[model samples]
Target: MNNPNQFIPTPYTNSVDSGNFTWSAPSNIALVKYWGKREPQIPANPSISFTLNKCKTITTLSFERKRHGGFSFDLLFEGQPKESFKPKILKFFERIESYLPFLTDFHFTIDTRNTFPHSSGIASSASGMAALSMTLMSVERLLNPEMTDDFFYQKASFLARLGSGSACRSIKGNLVVWGEHEDIPQSSDLFGVEFPFEAHEVFQNYRDTILIVEEGQKSVSSTVGHDLMNGNPFSEARFAQARTNLTRLKQILIDGDLKSFVALVESEALSLHAVMLTSNPYYILMKPNTLAIIEKIRKFRSDTNVPICFTLDAGANVHVLYPDEYKGVIKTFIDGVLSLFCEGGKYIEDKIGNGSELLTVNS
Candidate 1:
């Protein structure tokens, strides 16, 4: 499964004249952030994430047999034709066409919608691409009915990574690790693997309440941010630090050490931004409200002795993470205090979840 050649489909044993598939894939928050990457969507450092529940993307792909031609596809977002999204889809098709040869043999209509706002830094691309990859795998399965469940998911994740590196982690649930980490068995840079070890019960139902400090599009794209790492003086040390932190976090997960968890997760989040701040063409993604929320979270945790912590994506939004047992107190804290920092008081309540779902398939 590690070899990319294994994912290439053999000649179709069955023919599908027309078919449709629908899948829903959830977004994921990296506990060990994956900030930089190599070419072909490979990560520079290993990372693990908690798959989210409420924030997800649902996609339906319908295809009809067409005369042999180049890739032909139409994309719709929330039932509206979105021309801007086609280029990305087209590029994804080009990247994956070799693996799924049937792509050019059919005309595809991709209809997608996201529960969370797009490009607002909730990893919309991760969920969106994961959902699409899962849907496409259904078509592959139709052509090759003998495909095993393991092979199906592995290929889906592999394809998703080609679309977005983080998207691979969105394919699985609860805990997923991406990149070749020595401490994590079965870890691979090619696709995300389920965390093999059983985590302490305390982490089973962890909650993530995303405080949307600023929902507008970020000034710098993640692609540009990753590129800036090329000349970052601290790039090597940062990657080394992430590896060490991941090893420490693995033990913390098993022991259910909330204190250590809080420290590591927050440090990793800040370090991710620190790397950005120190890059050659440095830029800041955190807004004023973002810093305000972080300070408030720290003050509330110190005053109340609540095991709450904050993590940020490559955007201004802050993900308020806490154990499920403390949901009641945390909800009050968010409502009374944190919401004031959010734009229009916007936020999303979510929790750890089991991964993607195949909703329907018709042939």
Candidate 2:
């Protein structure tokens, strides 16, 4: 077999019965916005987010050590094998190995599943990678219990970023800020820090109604999204809008005001998509239902006089945000919208969720 401690051209599967490790990572919706990544690898642009309650992804990492050989890992998505799902997995392992070089030789088997629908534009990548980060940390603890939270976070967060730019936020709880520039102390790899205010205390009055229609995947990924945004003439415009949204949203979050929060959230989502509209060849991640949902939202907001905001990530799904107190009312509204639009208004409902951890670790 190949030497794992050293470099091996091919990946290998573990033979020993690897212990199980599980963790739940939340799907984060960017409030401040991260239109561009500075590093793309770890992302250069600073970002902020809210940890959703309902949307989550769980991950498990097990290891089977060989007496004298290299090891490999298998990824399972929702119990199905994740063959060639992403090259980032290997990159992630490599990043971790740099810190704990001693683990370079072990074999790995990873299994991940999302509580929310996958490819439904629900920030699956963020939660998936965050779950992986926490799972890996659990494994590390099992092998070496002396590691500290700071150490684990620093290393694991970086590792998670290798998988997906937003995954780093998933490792954090409540609210998190991705790396940002100085002149402001808000930016840094800080995970698990509660927002200055209580999430439930402040956001107890919000809701999100998502409409999942098949507008088809974009030719560009978020990485590409940032790339195009960087060169597009509207790049500076997007930046200005994002800055304003961030400044205003921060105040709303602190003030614990639901109305202002929803407005800012909806506006930011629109601004992000608008940039994609003017991209070089034209890229729009929206289905007819998406537009319909927007119209419905406008109508609903006007009818109820309650502010319900809608946001979309890189995917073609629409996420509706409202007060927690309005879930029942929102659910009814969502059902009505879906019923009226028939199959076009399909979508999965989700709330904020906790970040990653290990549920099981089989030895």
Best by lDDT: 1
Model 2 agreement with the true structure over 119-206: per-residue lDDT tens digits: 5557777888888877766666655565567666655665576677777777766676665433234355322233444444646434
Question: How many collisions per candidate?
Answer: 1, 29
Kindly give the stretch of ten consecutive residues in candidate 2 with the minimal lDDT sum.
Answer: 1-10
lDDT of 1 by residue, 259-309 (tens): 999999999999999999998788998889999999999999999999999
**Model 2 residue 107 distance off true place after TM-score fit, in angstroms:** 0.6
**Model 1 regions more than 4 Å off:** none
User: Candidate 1's error at 237, in angstroms?
Assistant: 0.5
In terms of lDDT, model 1 sits at: 0.93
Error of 1 at 233 (Å): 0.4
- How many angstroms is residue 311 displaced in model 2 relative to the true structure, after the best TM-score fit? 1.0
Candidate 2, residue 332: the lDDT equals: 85
